[model samples]
Target: MAAHEKMPDFDVIIIGAGISGINFAYRMQERNPELTYCILDGRHEIGGTWSLFQYPGIRSDSDLYTFSFAWRPWTGKDCIVHGSIIRQYLEDSAAQEGIDKKIRFRHKVNKLSWSSSPSMWDCDITVNDTEKMSLRSRFIFLGTGYYDYEEPLPADIPGIHKFQGKVVHPQFWPDDLDYADKRVVVIGSGATAITLLPSLATSAAHVTMLQRSPTYIASLPTRGVFEAIVLKILPSSMANRVIRLKWMLFSLFMVSMCHRFPRLAKSFFLRETAKILPPGMSLEPDFVPSYNPWDQRLCLCPNGDFYAAIRSGKASIHTGIIETITASSITLASGKELHPDIIMTATGLKLRLAGGIAITVDGEPYNLSDNFTWRTAMVEGLPNLVLSIGYTNASWTLGTDSTAHLACRLLNRMRKRGLSVIMPRMTAEERKELEERPFLALSATYVKEGGNVFPKTASTAPWQPRSYYWRDLAIARWGRYQERHGVVEIGLVTDLSR
Candidate 1:
């Protein structure tokens, strides 16, 4: 802390200038502009997750409607957009909404300490990763998406250090690294690996995706006829609305179908792949997943790009355990050896809370998992902290519509009640009544392995995320904030104003 430096003050502090933070800013601008706020992004850039990764083929697995902000109309080509496009959309939306002005780039929160007596958060801001500054706010909204951007999960493999090939992790892709005409082997069966396969295969000598097991892959049209008709016949705004509605309904229907008829859904996925896959290609060895649909996120092959690459002999999928990594080659447990010039570990991201920012209540750093979540937006008993996390099954932004609205409600409530602090505290009796459950049902290895550290949910109402969009819309978005939401108590304050 600078001894003579004067701390800046704001009513609310939003951490992360990413899409989620931008959406929060838009919502606040729409209904609560009078509330003072600042958008702080840890990175030098504004695009959060998109800006961080500079991989070969980075694109949104989910469609644009659900991935993008609700209030903003996604006039872009339907869904499955490239990362650069998404990044541009974020910047354009922020600039158009005048939210970009509020963003302070390279401002990372080093330490967050809550002052119980003052009912405020004292944050240590590291400017440009160097100079120290202080910021005080009544509330903090964590828009920092769930993953550790600085350090990805360790790809600790046996004989990894002995490998002479250049190893790469998708999280931190060096823009200047030349992989053109290089034989590349990507390890993993998750979204990152699936996305990287076709992309690297385009120019690489050969790209081999090595996975321990098969992952469910589904191929959909690059552009739908109905989507084209809707956009062509209707106004852009109307088209966006109609398309958004259609996608939402269709997403829900698909989810229901997967749960109700897993066998049929699984068969349909394979049947579709059968059409696109190369003749005599065995879907059983590498494409078919043992888990039911939605048990894990289905690998989306928009327009069958991945399969097309396989058919063209540009890429291949290999499934087996790794025996060892030899210089210029990888030996599999199945006695197959793949010689590659480069090995890219598309393993997975490490799930983290608030981007690994240290948060303390009363000067004591509290483990996030120690307390259960509230409405999936905040931690129980944590005062004036709102973490905006999106849905894993659908577009990440879908959950934000409700979360931002709920934050507005809480802030408004605080003003109406003339209070500085609002903490949702529950008794032991209440905690016991709440049913315990895992936060995510995702079958992806990264997600499943993150179980111990990931946030927990209660079976009790308002404590667990219903995982249904409509439920969130009714309770958090449009509905009034009530006591059943939690037992929120206020601290003494002479004046409370947004």
Candidate 2:
């Protein structure tokens, strides 16, 4: 189909109807009720990660109180909610907010190109399992969550094809694949593996967790006193403060536990983990993390299910590199062979920007790899494109909520000022100063490989702001409505016509 031949449907097109996209749609509607909009999701449903992740014992690692939309408080007492419940909540939110009508399911966006002449974007989209169609809009919002699709099953393993038993990736788990009374081996140590181990152990004859490197794991009560206080005393506007206080204490303890006393920290994790296991079972260091807490994602055990599975003698931990995979067994580098009825690879996901859509300005391709200064949520040079990247440590929604507010504020300012687009202008020297800073060096991949070209302030965490909710709240508030950092410049055509 010709790009321009596809009908232009709305003023703005939002990709992915996940939390970010849903919230963006709500905010945009609130701003202009009559403005036309359409939300497209590659999946058949609205909930992005929540809907895609069907592994057992799947739940939010972050607290639910602060993990949700600021406008809607989580009424559930459990601070960490399960995947099914979370998916339900998202569906309810869409229904209650009347945003479901705007969503187009099973519509995947394949390519996006911007025309400088019209200052608009032409998006190539596939809908209803049909041939690709075109969608043009004034602006494009990329809400495609960071974790794109399912984790890829390792393809390099020798004789992997010979595995006669079922081999699955957690991202693409089969609905009817039964693990009951069957031996299951789960590979990888990230969140998905941790979540899958305990759940499968409940029914599986035996389950083994294999990890190449150790990962930090922490356990906390699903419900807490501070959470109660926030529910009672704080309004939605002030809830961020309470969340910040809670996060501060938690982060501090995590840092100290991992850094000050490594042995003690390891012991603490093992001890707590041991509680869930059967009386005679032991918590091995092989499953525990070697890196400092928060260096990578800290695995969460919401209700000690992982430990419980181990205690019941249904699960075991194996730490070593995999040598090869046979039809019914996994051979480790140490010559240990694990026989399994099912092998679940919980490996990580591939990171793609803008839903893996290509971007072009004035028919010239724009490479995000070439730009590196991320300001607020806006890429440095990209106009009319805003990204939704969630928090690394705390609640993912917290960052997105704040980013949504800031984005709305910026958009409103531009409209009121009669500006079409806004771009941050950093000079060669100022850009150089930003480039030389060590703070920006932490996320080398995000900068170097992810094509995340933007000017970022020194104050953001899990990267710079310390991952404390309180510190980030302050930074978010300060930058939320600031117009100076992100200023609008009239396009040449608009200025000339004016």
Candidate 3:
């Protein structure tokens, strides 16, 4: 007879092998080479969200330098990269760093249970929608984005089912969707709708962008002069740093300029937009947004492609309320009808927490709103959990890298101190007294539609997202992280000596 010793699946578990998870894992593995880890994603491959979203002309809204990892300098000439290119970059990086071998794909986590008796996480997963798998780990890093995977938010239009041609959402774009030499109507004016308009217009007989109101649209050259000048003198890596700093500062200045001189900026943007519109087409009553710039995200069209589409008479913009969708077209409230061959609803995403997994700590289910975020990584009272969401205002990867690196630093510090558990122990008084704000500060339609159900941010340190990229970079990268302030603590479960 023999007694067998059990072993956990991994020393650390990071969910979703997207850019965020990959970067965090790299940082963690570099800091603690002894720790064994696994990366799990519901999808059958890495690239997480990028792999999930497949649509025509789908590309990053943010520039590559800011959107990519700080260490990975994007040497490509195009600042804005296509989704496939971005996906490949992630795949190649993971392969080069040996992180690809650690990924367990097709593992859809259904629940997560954190136990106190033996501090670890029980990650319940469903494989290929049939098989059940249970894995355990000492730490759980959730790189699962806030967007719901099941479906996009319901923006029910009258008679959508009656439409006979075709209806598509960018989230689940069919591989066989064809609109060549056909009329198409794209509903909504967000980034998706904006991207789709020019893309579909290239082959489609005509493409119509039908929106209820307007969203702010801005244009910049595909490549910046600042980057070109720096790369000429500096090495690619150092040139990247110089370009990123200048770009970041320029972004901050633009944001400040928008706030202080809204009218001046608004006038300039509309003027630029008017340059590419069809002759005598007023930007007002169609392109001009009622809200201020950066209220919702400003749509970016590289090389003025979106504007050039209209200028070439390949596309049209209609700002009117939709009455309903008919068999082959849409009916506006103004008694106008748009007969089109295809319809695309770019309504927005359905926001969800932890990919809608049932999470419990010590047998009690937790609500996201009940816990304030501690430095955008850990939630109040949640032990050994790090949320890897990105910035709403800046490049998503910028925030991702900062949060990932900071979490790695904390994990390394705990190992050095011989601590088994680390948690942000919030004071009850602080919880009651601290000013509460929405976790996502942006006024985007997606956030407005589905973000209320998620967590709330605090008005103070370690809880509030400063929203300033430079200020946050300093705090997350080099702040004096201490537990004596009573915000967070590290614990030794048993005897102090090993």
| Alpha-carbon lDDT, every model | 0.82, 0.69, 0.82
Among all candidates shown, the one with the greatest TM-score = 1
TM-score for candidate 2, residues paired by index: 0.83
Evaluate residue 457 in candidate 1 and report its C-alpha lDDT on the 0 to 100 scale: 85
Q: lDDT by residue for model 3 over 388-484, one digit each (tens)?
A: 8887667888788778777777777667777767777666776787898888877877788787766768777777854777666677778776753
lDDT of 2 by residue, 83-159 (tens): 88888888888888899998989888877787655666788888877878887776677888665574443435567
Cα-lDDT of candidate 3: 0.82
Models sorted by lDDT, best on top: 1, 3, 2
Total backbone collisions, model 1? 1
* Total clashes for model 3: 1
Model 2 global lDDT (CA atoms, 0 to 1): 0.69
Off by over 4 Å in 1: 1-8, 478-485, 492-494
TM-score of 3: 0.95
Top candidate (lDDT): 1
lDDT for residue 194 in candidate 1, whole number 0-100: 88
**Which residue runs does candidate 2 get wrong by more than 4 Å?**
1-9, 31-34, 150-158, 225-284, 425-430, 436-488, 492-498
Instruction: Give candidate 1's TM-score.
Output: 0.96
